[model samples]
Target chain A: MSDSRVSSVIQEWAYSSQAHTQTLNPTTTNHAGSTSQLTQMDMIPYSQSQGLVRGGTDDRVTEQMMGLSYLPYTSSSCLSNSSSTGTTNHHQGHPNTQQDFSSFLLPSLRAPVNKRSISKDSAEYRLRRERNNIAVRKSRDKARRRILLTQQRAQHLQEENQKLQMRIGQLTQELDTLKHILSQRHLHGAEEGVAGESNI
Target chain B: MSDSRVSSVIQEWAYSSQAHTQTLNPTTTNHAGSTSQLTQMDMIPYSQSQGLVRGGTDDRVTEQMMGLSYLPYTSSSCLSNSSSTGTTNHHQGHPNTQQDFSSFLLPSLRAPVNKRSISKDSAEYRLRRERNNIAVRKSRDKARRRILLTQQRAQHLQEENQKLQMRIGQLTQELDTLKHILSQRHLHGAEEGVAGESNI
Candidate 1:
């Protein structure tokens, strides 16, 4: 295809993809959404169109939306006209560009439902940056969990130490009493021996 | 004082302490009726002698008598002969020997009530050892407590993370729904726009 023709095709695809994204954004707001209405409407047609666009699910749409927002475009409305058009010719007919586009959209499509978020592709530089933010948040949560566990263990040990000390004190007191009785018994025996000597 | 003098003093004290101790023994199985009564009366004189020898109370006399069993003697009956001979010029004065005597007698005087059984000393030793053991136990308890707390905190964080995930999912769904509605509205607008243009 001619360069101009390829550019037009790319623009048309991008616009349709954007439109589809707008349609899906509300559904992906919650992982548990009633997509039965849309799903029931026409499964085949929707899936077919889904196959055409890189991001078929609403989650992907949000990821991509956030990804798009991170782009250098100061104005959200003018992104396609300025940046999209400028980068169009460079990616045309490039295998790497196609791969990048697929990578950018596939993660959002297949990301764990609980942790749904965008992953960036080489070409989807704007989306890739957004994915980094999510990764950072996950690590911080893990560290906080570790610190909390450490503190609890310390408190438990202190309580146990105190109980053991009380037990030792009680044992010492009993020992002392036993020793006292033994001494008194010895003295009585001595007196009897002396009295026997006096009788002799 | 000289070593021999110290030894003699210790021996004399031990011998005297031992004689008085036999008179005070409570577990005499002697069936001699008059001898038993005489033995009991003799204990008061013996006690006074012990008080003169060490210048201490009955409690101290008892403490020393109990300490004797841990020594080499079999019976308190040998105390009379042992006293005069033990205190001869043999041990006149030695600080180390004196210290030894002091240590042996100190417990009885200082802790008179502790003369229950050999367990009294053992209990004291055990208490010391236990105190050390508690230090170790405390550390372990601390570690365990820390782990429990960590687990609890992690559970709390997990709950929060789950809630946030749920919220994110809901927001995604809402966004998707909104986008779907917008698309329907826009599609309707586009259809109306086309009809109007065709008429014009």
Candidate 2:
């Protein structure tokens, strides 16, 4: 909600658009049925990276708030909460540590933590990831809603069309029946007139 | 573009929405603050595990494709291209050998990879993600245009309102002037009549 966050989100959005334009342009020009994912995966890292950066800043702010609260109030409840969180983090961190170790199985992972630790970038990267994830959710909801609305509109139109067709068919049948009756009456009157003239 | 990818993307989208709704739901007994990345970090291990599975699949596909193209029926140019790609990949594969590892890094490398490695899921996710980004852009643009149009309309309305107020004021002034002139004429006529009567 911070101005900085909004600014960063906007900045990242611009970057994302440029990335999309670049990827789509290549697909159109080469006629290579390039997988949309290929372009997407290629572009996502930047967005993710941006998100991570933003997230880190947000995290820092949270940390600062926690730090400030810790300083002034010295509330026993707050301390207890922090301690409980620390303990919980420790418990959860274990599984993640095991998983992180496994990531090193990749040749890329052979490079020591000092070299490849996205840790420095992790804060911002994490933020961006979270933001992108949120944005992704929003868009998905929007799309689903759009699709649903479109389907509904189509159904309404179809119903209207069917009703119109039925009305036209009914009118046509009525017109035919009226014409037949009129013709028959006209013929019968002609015959009567002819017979009357003969009688005269 | 595969049906599977689409479905999973839909699932991912659904899951994300569920998560967001869960987060936003005020009625729910369960409340989680935006502060804790602890839950997110816990999920990271699962994501990493998923990433490993995906990496294996990608390697398997790449290798299988490489093997398939090994036959003589595959053109020399195609074979050469594959060989070059393989060599390039192999060379690129070594972490220590590369001076510019950043260039070699896939967007996936820096980001979290989900366990569901299907292109279908990713394609759908990417589609959703791109769509979301586009939607954000579109909504923002719409809002901006709306603001500008509203401002223009307001200015016009304000101008119109001012002109009307001025016209009302002018009419009031004219009425007042006409009343004063009529009253003065009446007074003069009354005085003249009185004077004439007195003279008679």
Candidate 3:
């Protein structure tokens, strides 16, 4: 086929890609309307140890791991709501699935080494790029969330540390007062020291 | 080249690949002799917010984000130590970096659609596969580390909760003891109420 024909075919592929996405993501399509249920589950627990991310059945973790805000754009409205992050492209459909691979083809993205660089024009190359992009984003976001959650955890621990210190202070002060009272009574020559007066 | 010559060239490429990796990983090599210092830093904080993972400066996070056990296998002994996770490849200059993509070519990995499968026999195709493999592994290890860290955090929080609960119990018991003693003294017709006796 000539170059013009290939370009025309590419345009056709671009338009129908949305419809094709439904097929590419049957699992996601099945998951479309059930986001509300996933939201409820997210509120309960989202533990990988709990087997929340089983293979094939749903390699996807609980929506909590991905964050409700980052959950797949199961609908057009949800897509718009999550657009600000620009990280939602590969959220199991929602069109433009190839954008990651396409964007990755930045003219400046030569390999880190100096030997002959690889070609960029093959179908396998394109598909590999697409998957790599998806996985990379997924990985990076996972890292970011891990850091954020840890930060939150550190904050909580710090607060708890402060509270525990304060409680110890209060208890120590109260103990000091009680001991002082008991000692003062002894100095005043009461026959009964606090111990002697106490009937156990 | 003839088929036999091609096979010989492939062998040569494999051998020299290790030497070439040093070029691919100048940053990681610079980090090689300084791992002990990085270990000391690990005992402190490992926050992304603190700019611990500045791009290219050190795309790597703290040695903590990756457990010290998993810190790039920077030495030969370290490589053996990390053999169990089978994830030590792509740690800047490890050999056999093509495994992920090579493994990805399993016949079972045909596209999810009915379209003709992509051609996988070009130089660019192989390199892209190689890089994609590295990225996928990097991404996956990151995720595993994330889940593990969260698990550790959860365990620490649970332990703290139990300790706090025990502490509250202890405080309550002490308060009850003090209250009982005061009440008994009052019943014995002490002139001073415990509260009035306690001058702040």
Candidate 4:
């Protein structure tokens, strides 16, 4: 699939998940007005095209919509698991629906959805997703940078530790040498004392 | 002083320096044997006499010991500059003295020898100083634990950079609410959208 097409599907999925969330939870009413505005602004073109597709085969449309609806439920479930497992179960459950969606769209529906939604939801989705993608990328990059810095720091610390260990070895060696020198000096002093004793 | 007395004096200085380092630098060598041995063998006499001086010259002893010998000249420079530049010039001039003699005692020392030798020549000086103090504490800690673990990590990273900021307060508040509901319905969904959203 084309990059643009994949992004559009992801946006639709995001929107479906969001809509399901709004429907399931009423407390999100505070942002309802803005979300509805966004939906109307973003969804009108895609919805219109969807209306055109609706005319062709009612059964397939119903099945696809039903599958789309089920998506939000699964996605919501996936979102819930996101914290602990992170996309594992979501990815597991996603391929079936996503494959169905992709296959169904890949045929006659693909052309219409792509053309119409491209102007509206696709653009908005692309923009928003791009922005979000940038944010996620930035976040990941930042985390990566932190990890890189940390790794560098760890490397530097290990180097310092090695240097310190080397220093300790050197100091120990020097101390041994000094002790040897001191002992030699002590022997010389003892010999001098013996000579003085013999003369006395 | 006799050689035994000189050794004793050096050992006393080591003990005093160790005590001072423990006070100044908390995270240090974990080897308890040497420290405990030092305490039992060396500290008893000093502690007992400290009790005696707890009667007579406590303040004077503290004062004198404080001024005794910051033998790691770099450490003294660091202590001096800690209030100012932290660890600026420390690493630069270190290797010269450190590399030499690893055993040779310095002579005619520069600052009254502090009533004890604190020069680069002092093996005990390097060992005591380097073991206790590292140049990069915050960086090392940050690297060791990763930014995700520390509240201060966020603060420090934020201070270091202003670009990677997120709405932490809003995210945290939303997360708390989500976590509350998630705990309530954890059995029902067995998936976690809330967590995934929060991570994003």
What's every prediction's RMSD, in angstroms?
A: 48.6, 29.7, 18.0, 40.3
Each candidate structure's TM-score, on Cα atoms with residue i matched to residue i, is 0.20, 0.26, 0.30, 0.23
**Once superposed on the true structure, which residue ranges of model 2 sit more than 4 Å away at CA?**
A1-200, B1-136
Ranking by lDDT: 3, 1, 4, 2
Compared with the true structure, the alpha-carbon lDDT of candidate 3 equals 0.38
The superposed Cα distance between candidate 2 and the true structure at residue A122, in angstroms, equals: 4.6
Docking class of 1: incorrect
What ranking of all candidate models by DockQ puts the best one first? 3, 2, 1, 4
Off by over 4 Å in 3: A1-158, A186-200, B1-125, B183-200
Tens-digit lDDT track for model 4 on B93-145?
11111222212333421113345644422456535433333323323332323
Query: Which 10 consecutive residues of model 1 chain A have the lowest summed lDDT?
Result: A73-82
> Which candidate number has the best lDDT?
3
Candidate 1 deviant stretches above 4 angstroms: A1-200, B1-128
Interface Cα RMSD, each model: 45.6, 27.8, 16.8, 36.6
Tell me how far the alpha carbon of residue B106 in candidate 1 is from the true structure, in angstroms, after superposition: 43
The top-ranked prediction according to TM-score is 3
lDDT of 4: 0.31
TM-score of chain A for candidate 3?
0.36
For candidate 4, chain B by itself scores a TM value of: 0.18
Query: How much is B40 displaced in model 2, in angstroms?
Result: 30
Q: Name the candidate, 3 or 4, with the larger TM-score value.
A: 3
Which residue pairs in model 3 clash with each other?
none
